[model samples]
Every structure is written in C-alpha cells, then in structure tokens.
Target: MTAVVALLRAVNVGSRTVRSAELKAVATSLGHTEVVTYVNSGNLVLVPADGASPDDVAAGLSAAFESQYGFAVPVVARTAAEWELVVRALPFRAEAESDRSHLVVYCWDGVPDVASIRTFDASVYGNETVIWHGRETYAYYPDGIGRSKLTLPVLSKAAGRVGTARNWRTVLALQKLAQERS
Candidate 1:
C-alpha cells in the first residue's frame, strides 16, 4: 500500500463547505486505511487501497464529495514519496513561513505547459515568482495574496488548469503529517 495525501481545492472555504471528518470517512470507504485530516482545507493522509492508482483514489473522493455536497470538488493526490520530494525541493525552506504569501500545489492530471508557467506576467509582484516542480507549481508572493496581481484566477486563465493554494504553514504541516505516517 502506498501512502497518499489527497488535497482538495476550494472546499470548505466560505459558503461551500464539506466537513473534514466526512472527507476522512469517504476516503476510508474507498479502501484507504489510517485516514487522517489536517486543518480544514481538505488535506488527508492515508494508505491507498492495494492496486489503486492516484487518480482512482482522487476520483472516488471527488465523486463522494459531489454526491454529498451537490457540487463537484476536484481532488489532487500525492504519494508520500512525491510529497517528501516537494518538501526537499522547496527553494526557501529556512525562510519564515509568514513571509511568503501563498504556496500553490498544482494537481498532476496532465502535462504542464512550461510556456504557460514562464509566460505568466507578475512584474507587479516583484519578488514573487512561480516555480514548477513536477506536477505541482509553487508560488511565493512577498505581498499578500489578495493584493498581489498573481491571483489564482490569473493562473487559471493562463495555465488553463485547476490548482489549489495553501499558506506556507499549511504546506509544512502536511509535510509533517507525511513524516509522522512514514
């Protein structure tokens, strides 16, 4: 069984909400064992059912969320080894967590267009930049995300893909969870 983490995008943020406990239950039903949730942004750590692909696990959770909430919520799954690589590749691991604006984890559904990531216009963001590491893209904006010109909407428009962004602290916390289970 491979350890996988399912990261839900835009769930439980404002008006549209799904309970974290329910997310855990849904994953459990899908044959994921030892399911654990961290925070409310839909971060879950579990061991995928034997022979279940990442996409299979994601689809099960996404379908469950849609049926329960009456809306579709996209889910991104990362293996424990994959997440550990992301943590190790962090450009500024020692930087204060609060200093960075947001950390975007791009779902690895399809091939990411390199041109799209580089063509992004963020001069207004100054120090803020985007780095594509495998399927996930990490962005650091010195200014607040709300104020920064590089918003999630902008990325969606340019990249033509769905993604989720959490604060740096949240990313690290997920990393810690991976370590604990490992």
Candidate 2:
C-alpha cells in the first residue's frame, strides 16, 4: 500500500463545510485503508487501493465527496515522497522566520508553466515573494495573508492554476503524518 496525502480545497471555508470525520468515513468507504484526517480543513492521509494513481485517488475522493455532500470539491493528491520533496524545496524560508504562519505552499493538480507564473507582476506587493516550481508555489505574505494584496484569488489568476494553500505548520504536519503512515 502506498501512502497518499490529499489536500482538499474550499472545505470549511465560505459555504463549503465538511467534517473531517465524515471525510475519513468517505475514504474508508472508497476502499482506502488507514484513513486519517488532520484538522477540519480537508487534509487526509490514506493508503491508496492497489494500483491507484494519485490522480485516481483524488478524483475518486472528490467524486464521492461531491455525490455525498452535494458540492464539487477539488482535491490535490501527492505521494508521500512527492510531498516531502515539496516541503524540502520550499523557497522563502527566511520569511517564515518572522511569521511562519504567513508562509504558505500552494499545490495544484500539476506543475504550472514557470513563464506563466512569472508573468504576473507580483511586484505590486513589494514585500511579498512568490517562487513557482514544479506543482508547488512557495509564497510569503509578509503582512499576513489575510491583509496582503497577493491573495489566493490573485494568485490563482496569475499562476493560471487554481490550487489550495496551506500554511507552513499545516504543510509540516501533513508531511509528518504522511511520513509516519509511510
């Protein structure tokens, strides 16, 4: 069994609300083993059924979740090893020194073109920095993400890929949990 980390977007935010326990049950019902949900914001660590790709796991979970809950939810799934690489390669580590909570990693379905991400004039927020590579975007919101102009909406538009953002602590926790499961 291969451990996979699933990151769900738009859960427990705005009009979408999904209980973590229910998410775990859904995973178990879909044949995932050792299902565990971290926090309530849609982070799950589970072993994919044999021969299931990350995309298959994510698509299956997303479909089942929407069918059961009546809303379309986007999920970004990564293997435990991939997740660890993302964590290790995160840029702007210095930004976390002052405000670790403001440092976030956005993971999309696949790697967005670096040219597209660079085309965005991120300079509008002089203090903010964005590093795009592979399927992850490492960002630092110096004034706090909530108060910053480089919001998720802006980032999604700029990167040309919609993704879910998790803070440094959440990313670390997921990595730790996935490692333990692996």
Q: Which candidate wins on TM-score?
A: 2
Model 2 pairs whose backbones collide: none
Pairs that clash in candidate 1: none
lDDT tens digits by residue: candidate 2, 26-122: 9999999888998999999999987588999999999999999899898999999999998889776676666888899989887776776767777
Q: How far is candidate 2 from the true structure (C-alpha RMSD, Å)?
A: 1.4
Off by over 4 Å in 1: 94-108, 124-127
Output the lDDT of residue 29, model 1.
81
Global lDDT of each model? 0.74, 0.87
> Per-residue lDDT of 85-165 in model 1, one digit per residue for the tens?
877777755354546445544555544667886777667556677776667667776655666777766766566666666
Show how many residue pairs clash in every candidate, following the order shown. 0, 0
Clashes of 1: 0
Error of 1 at 23 (Å): 1.0
Lowest lDDT sum, 10 consecutive residues, model 1, at 100-109
